[model samples]
Target chain A: MAKAKLDKEKLLWMYRMMLLIRRFEERTAQMYGMQKIGGFCHLYIGQEAVGVGTVAAMKKGDYLISAYRDHGHILAMGTDPKPVMAELFGKATGVSKGKGGSMHLFDNEKGYMGGHGIVGGQIPLATGMAFAIRYKKSNQVVVCSFGEGAVHQGAFHESLNLAKLWNLPVVYLIENNRYGMGTPLERASAVWDLSQKACSYDMARATVDGMDVLQVNEAMKEAIERARQENQPTLIEARTYRFRGHSMSDPVHSHYRTKEEVEEQKERDPISSFQAYLLDKKILTKKMADTIEDEIKKEVMDAVKFAEESPLPSLESRFSDVYA
Target chain B: MAEITFREALNQAMAEEMQRDENVYLMGEEVGYYNGAYKVSQGLMEKFGASRVIDTPIAELGFAGVGIGSAMVGLRPIIEMMTFNFSILALDQIINNAAKLRYMSGGQFKIPIVFRGPGGSAHMLAAQHSQCLDPWFCNVPGLIVMTPSTPYDGKGMLKTAIRDDNPVIFIESESMYGFKGEVPEEEYLIPIGVGDIKRGGSDITLVAWNKMVHVAMEAAAILEKEDIEAEVIDPRTLKPLDEQMIVTSVEKTNRCVVIEEGWPYAGVGAEIAARISALAFDSLDAPILRVSSEDLPMPYAHNLEKEVLPSVDKVVRAAKKVLYI
Candidate 1:
């Protein structure tokens, strides 16, 4: 409760968390390229602000749920890197005991609902989580995250309608990174402004600059506050971009997007922008930032080593976790 | 104990579970004010109110997924899909999300939810809304598929499905909703993953479920008249099938015939038939016969409708085939 403001320490913590997420992703992408990690890997590089900002607004009783680009949310919510990395390595020590790699990370202890694989699959699930919070008459809210792509799924619309009708304490966030795999946002959706789509359900909705941590945090704070106080749901469309391809399997050339466009968006990088804000505000010295980077780099390296040493789940494991 | 109709018994099971636990709730298309399309959720909206006895949109997959999510947190939600045919829209949520969550999350999440509704052919409703989906879902792991024929079984099995820590598919019958039968008034629960024997004999084993259970009983009666004698078995729960009951019956009779309203190829009957063939291989006096719906969409006409679904006549014919009579 003390010093919750974006002061030097808090900003530093944010940077450290985002840095950890970024390092984990960068090396994870490299690992994927090296064939160390298997299955679909959706990097959370450009969209770190969305996870970091929104999770900051969440409390102990609050819950979080998201699509496959979920490593960042889990890490930010305080899940150990070893288990998550082990999950990536398909090892038994993983969060999902190696059965759910990349896309199905779950940490119930940390209030992280899941890293659901199917698009828009978690929307109704998250709505139900909020329903539970309200049903129990608790003050907790749920942050249900989905990509702009999920707007096409029927669950998305259905959940929104129910949440609005019931006045459940839920925050429906759309990480509009402007692309759905190979399809750009323009081609994928007729309505370019995703937040406005919520108006049809008569739900409170807005859009924010997803690359700016401050803007996203401010938006999330308002949404979370309204959800808890008024028992109303909020929909936020954070307009952002992905620094990498959709997945490791996707080639840069197969899509309609150009390298120039990607490089141009890199100029508005969230991490770099936050760093600039810190330097201007004199929140942290350049040397201190460098030390934090070194520490995070070591953590990522240690995680990679532990994952390498971790044992793979046995063939018998295919039957073990079905019950418990 | 007071006797209740199948419809009243189903209502009692849900009402009792909801009264006993704060987490139990029922939601469906017409389960609220309209008092259940088949009256299974009768007076529930009054007892539990509109919030818990929720009447949702016609979107089956959407509401079904919501029920899965609600169950994931702490509530036990029974999502009613007016009939099993309507469950097709929500199949992905039921099969993919609900059925796979517990295993997919590696024991982190439990979908203690129920997708309950009437199943099998429902008399002249035509192709799209009358065919059964038990076979499609029984194939999926992490789910307990159930079809209750008797009022007592309906009351007991539904209560069990509500309390289970995994997703359960509870099938009812539009044809048997109003059927009168004795149901225990006391709070009773039948364990899931276990089958039940409705009638017992020794000449042959006739296994069926839902409306087919009646067919099995009818076949048993016909065999009784012919002095052939048959054991009528209903594997109430489909997924964690009661192979023991089927095997034991086949051992006693040395012959078996499985009846299902689903199509002949790859129906729930096929799975039980194969298991019977394996378990009762040495004990069998004749081959295992399957009495199943013809592999086609149900027609709107009454005669075609009767012919399309597995009936008492089919069960009798199938029993003769197994007995070589």
Candidate 2:
């Protein structure tokens, strides 16, 4: 699969998003190891291209929602890490004003509905979001991202049925990271082929190379285009993987796979693959790319400072904002 | 004032509101063509047309979520849940999305959708169908749960709920639908969270709502024979609880009896009993009395259903016990 005709800036922006996500998660993993970040932390280590590349294809007006491993999705959707970290820190300055911790980052202003906790909970929600856009007659499509694990939820089936039936403008992104929490997807799922699930709903289904940003962007451009024009939902399985344990609680045990398997997947790492592609095409110089990395590192550091400096919500503030 | 049934009053409210707001639309199972399961939305299809009034497939969660999303984008949707029993299917949309959207969105969006229908036990309706979700929804913080009993309340409170800028779970009773009461033809609104004192007296404060309000009324009427002169208070909206009206009634009567068709252990009656006792502990003439539905699955037999649900006799007995008769 090939990417669309893109100017230097668009490619650079995509590069920056993938770089930002990689750096952010790297810092998060480091902090999590240091016991700075607590609770369920699922990293998008190998699946950077799926979220970043797809989000880059969508407009700012379009909606994007995803699952618990959503730090990358939010960053890829363009939320400042200060608010994102403040949220991870449970500070008031976070996206949900600190009410939603790491697992529930929401920035509706930027069209990122949320990082839902429950598996497949956001499926119905995303469909409903698309329904709203349809009801209002808006051209915006909702990019609803979920893991291969979520296909089993009743909500997933119900939402797919409804979204397909109504022909709502939404793109159902299945980030097949090869494992659900801890269990490898092949062992858990009855239908090992992920994109086949979409066929049942009569939706346009495709499998993109998750390790390649160009392929992801091309698939997303088509999916997003179909959603906008035809107002039909598309199911895309981005065959990807995670290079670490499900969370910080588990050790990097190889009970499920061998070291050789892990090593093989790492070779097709999305960030590195996209970086190589960009360089080989001569779209960017090494110095310019280094400048981008330096800028992101500086921004991540600044975001940490901003999060630390932000004030915590007051005790009495708990009673407020339950309803409008 | 003209006498109207609870169902008629509700229909009038929808008709009037639809006439008033251009953005408002009615949608649900049997809401249009079949005229609603309970006929609360009877003949709405002809009156409002298919665009304004819709009969959706039996997809409660799907449609409810649609209503929430529609509400997000400035469409005021009034969704009819055939009964409170079916609402369990849409609990995800009601609880997670509708209730929490505004708060979760950091006060960025307002959900102005009404999930309205009959609640509480109806005769011959089996275990799966017969149950009151008042106490269940009242426990939820974000929802404004309204259980309107009389024709006046059915008309007035629904108007308020439709106009309200939050997700209002408007609960009614199947038993109260045919019960006729005076309703004003002119436009009016009964504010949510306000308690109505139906019959005031000095002996005891009998707090109830929805169909149980009628039971309390019958009990109050019977208590008059014993010269008990019971005061009847209806806590129309449960979440806001009407503490001031309840406290005032308890302060004056100094005795209370709460009747509900939900299980006694942790029902609306429990909340009323606890709240009144906590507020008017010194003013009590006797310990608070509660007459509630039997704790079991409501059977299909009419006799068994009647025995399980609260009735006039139980309410009267509870009143007498509270008044130390």
Candidate 2 error regions (>4 Å): A1-4, A254-259
Highest TM-score, which number?
1
Supply the DockQ value of model 1: 0.69
For A1-324, candidate 2 gives per-residue lDDT tens digits of 355477878888888888888888888888777776678887777888899879878986998989888899988888998888877766778787777777777777788877777787778778877877776688999999999898987778878888898889999999998877668887788987788988898999999888888788888988999999999999999998888777667655467777788888899888777777788888877998899999999998888778778888777767777867
What's the distance in Å from true for residue A295, model 2? 0.5
Deviation from native of the Cα of residue B91 in model 2, angstroms: 2.0
The pairs that clash in candidate 2 are none
Q: Could you tell me which 10 consecutive residues in candidate 1 chain A have the lowest summed lDDT?
A: A1-10
- After the best TM-score superposition of candidate 1, give how far the Cα of residue B202 lies from its true spot, in angstroms: 1.7
